[model samples]
Target: MCTNTKENDMDIYEFYSGRSFDAYRELGAHVKKEVTGKKTVVSGVEFVTYAPNALGVNVIGEFNDWNETVMERCYDGSFFKVFVPEARPGMMYKYKIYHRDGSSMEHCDPYGFGMELRPAFASIIRDMDTYRFHDAKWMKNRSVCQGSPLNIYEVHLGSWRTKPVFDEQGNPLTPEEIAESNRVAESWYTYKEIAPMLAEYVKEQGYNYVEFMPLSEHPSDQSWGYQNTGFFSPTSRYGTADDLKEMIDILHQHNIGTILDFVPVHFALDGYGLARYDGTALYEYPSNDVGYSEWGSMNFIHSKGEVRSFLQSAANYWLSEYHFDGLRMDAISRIIYWMGDESRGVNDRAVDFIRNMNQGLKDRHPSIILCAEDSTDFKGTTKETKYGGLGFDYKWDMGWMNDTLNFFRTLPFVRGEHYHDLTFSMMYNYNERYLLPLSHDEVVHGKATIIQKMAGMYEEKFPQAKALYAYMYAHPGKKLNFMGNEIGQFREWDEKREQDWDLLKYPNHDSFHQYMKALNKIYMKEPALSAWDDDPNGFAWILCGKENDVVYIFQREVNEDKVIVVLNLSGLVYKNYHFNYENGDTMKVLINSDWNKFGGSTKDTEKTIKGVNGDFGFDLPAFSGIYLKPVD
Candidate 1:
């Protein structure tokens, strides 16, 4: 074992001060090389860890037959290190920490880059430089995607699609036999295996980005990776760390941006994980009242400088090392307020940590996007941290999702009473640069799927859903839809099952898919809908006073490009419905949600109308939406 006196002291000081955003580079298991005299060289793996309260720490792994090798203490006896010449890439290892009271336990490395697949937990030594990225052009041109189109398809990687298990005869396994076997484990596609398939699907669906739910190592499959064990490690459920790099590289080559969901609030309570490292509550709160989250996990104690460094470093590691274009931070409300409860007042320390981390990340990567999945009414979520605000590029508009879905779920005859549900969003639309989301959270846990949440049964849901999407695209924000939503799947989202792909065999489902594709096309082609989304003047309500009519009219305009959107949510059709149009411009129908090709009653015909004497007239159909643009 050899010690390097040069950079160790400075790195440890920065780590303890919470200023080390790249702590993983210095703290994790890294292979080192030393030049001995003229051309002689020596190589070994160097392990480093921080356990301030521990009596001692030992390096134990495959290199030493799982035997404990005592590590040298340094810098006020808080940090430990050891060199193992036998250690190499692909070997599993862990730290054996000895407590002050003479107790001992083995814990995975806090900054490990790879982890063993659970029900087994071990940190794997990995060569971080093995995979060479070829995404220079994509990286050079990547931005925050502001003032541009950003339609994200949120996906849960494992359940997006599963491999079909086959028997020895090369036929697919019977449902019963598959169930009797370890089907869940057998059906997962490795990260490298799923890349091309996912790229093709996302491209065909016309989405510019894919936001993975979470890929951090967690013991339970049911948590959907929200509760994490290995903060810096990619989950072994998919493949190695390099395998994940290949997946991102493939997606980037296909001109698709990738976003990873990052959790900073809590961690899993697994015995071998970060729950009680060094036999103390080092990474989490000590008392259960504030320590345990609603999800039954340990809440991170962000007041500690080490924990702050660890979380931010992990966030930076994904963007810097794995080449993710963005990170959508999960549950910001919990970070802003204790247990996400406003009544508990604000968490000032956690709030400060967020600002500092975001500012630091922005300084490092100016082009990458940092979004928040925050539901709180916290001010300045998307504002720059230098201006006393959270430095996020975008924030999810949870209010709009709730109000709109609730309005759609109400019976149509009574919908007039809730007309403002559609209009209320505009009142606060520009509060933070928003991204309207129909995410996985809305379609799970006994809540119905987006399609099933519509007011009526069978045939009636299609037109309303079509109309709802048109409104969503027309609204002043970016977009994100869960994996199964575009196909109008009736089943709720489940982590274990793939989306109902067979649903597309039916006409209603197939037509909806086509409609979604066409809608995406229009959204992409029309700059008016997205180019000036954050500008207050970009959208205007042309007609919204008649609540009893249940008809809403709006216009979105950018520069010389403009589009008028009309929606009639009631069951009654209005013939020659006249609305004021001061410009008296000739208009052509762009996309009618009631068109026959999209499973609607109206014939597939392009209709044109002219505004005369400051009034424009058109036939309005029930449960329909129409987009019209002035003829050039």
Candidate 2:
């Protein structure tokens, strides 16, 4: 039977009122040590769960030989708990919940810190305190990075780079043998094994942060960890919970921040998971019309206090326990309006829950970032909650992503008609603290890769692709690019195979890689590009209304330091083209996308040009971009 104490009653009140942010500490399987008057210590594990609708509950696991041990109900008749001296770390367990109709079902613990791999559905006992992190200095100095460069490299760990499979003789396995065996497990590198490799690669590539797709325990690899079954459990496919901790620790040691992709809207519909939990729709909405999401998963009913507490606690658990620097909340538009349809009216209950959760998380982790991946034009997504906003530090600019990609995909002859698509983003750039993303979503499911999306022949595509990237970097906002984007992979991203790293052997692809690396370096080193990104005075358009010329010129400035960007999207070159500039300032070419070294035909010449009487002239190559900075 469970021990009853006044402290437990208070915790239950807080949990049910949606006020407990650290509910994992009180609800899950916790290893405890009790000291007696004789100064000897007794060690045991205590299990706790909340199931108000259940008639009774039993704790059954390996320690008890899978036999049912009845749990004691607390005074409130909502929570059940049991203490077992025989329970040890690494033992698997589940709660057997008995419905009022005398039917019983075994369910994995919602707050379990570790879970079994797929095809298995048991929660494992894990010691969360075993791994000590050595990232105190990184943790202490971390911030939202509002005024600093925030170039992110988004990765899907499972397919980033798979390990080689070996047979029983310690030789590399043949293709037939790998196909016959469990290829999924054979290809994956554990979290600890991939830490150093990932750190070195990301640091070398010049990305300051790495945003991984959802890492929570899920049933389908195809879902990419979006449909979670265990909210608090890190998926065991990567390794044990401590292994994931070590991965984050290694990233911090390399001075790179880690951001977790969190899903707060839905859960997997697998029967063994949260579906009909406790013999009732406790976590999800009672009706299918509003309960099921468009992705065929259960929608969390945030109106329930218990549901809010469960989700908010799960969000807090990752940031507080795992040392993650930020959380990128996914599908926030679904939370703002019913079924993500603005006409269906706002989901006030869900919105309030979001506001409360965000406010609470910020109060707890003041320096950590809270980003929203919302597509709605819903106002104040990055505003403070006290001033009637959603309280996010950054919001993904979906408008900019769609518009810019559409412009690049148009044929050069017809690009004049779509010129405003590139300039439209600035009309509302400051609506929220935006992050410009070229994420994995844009490259998957027949959308084509970034380079492949260009509208031209194979040779013509390279220069246009180079020009597209130059324009993206010079635009206002934070930046994020998927793993394979930097290398100009022609093939779409596939989760089953590793990235086409072999593509680097080709001269065109290799040169594109070098160009991307150089662009990243300039972005990180220049203060004018990032230091005043959110300020209105940082950007100005010198040539926006000329649609027929298929040209764009803009100036990005921070105080006295300034840089001018010129882009030519047409097939015609403009020799000695003149544009208005600051008077008497000599301008030098910083980076030219059409240079021969970057797979272009432009020959090297005098790079510096003088601005006389507020006019600067330079040769603008076809389908090219160049950055010009004022000389001292």
Which candidate has the highest TM-score of all?
1
Candidate 1, 1-632: lDDT as tens digits: 34567764447667778888988887879976668777634377888888888888998889999999999886657788887998988999999999999998888998888889888888999888779999999999998888889999999998898888898889887444665675777778999999999999999888999999899999998999999999989999899999999999999999999999999999999878898887789999999999999998999999988899999999999999999999999999999998999999999999999999999998999998888999999999999998999999999999999999999999999999999999999999888999999999999988999999998888999989999999999999999999999999899887777788989999999999999998988898899999899998799999997789999999999998899999998878989998986666588888998888999877777577777866888888898999998774
Off by over 4 Å in 1: 7-10, 33-42, 167-171, 174-181
Model 2, span 427-449: residue lDDT tens = 99977899999999999999999
lDDT of 1: 0.90
TM-score of 2: 0.96
Clashing pairs in 2: none
Q: Would you list the C-alpha lDDT of every candidate in the order shown?
A: 0.90, 0.89
List residue ranges in candidate 2 displaced over 4 A. 6-10, 34-42, 166-182, 603-607
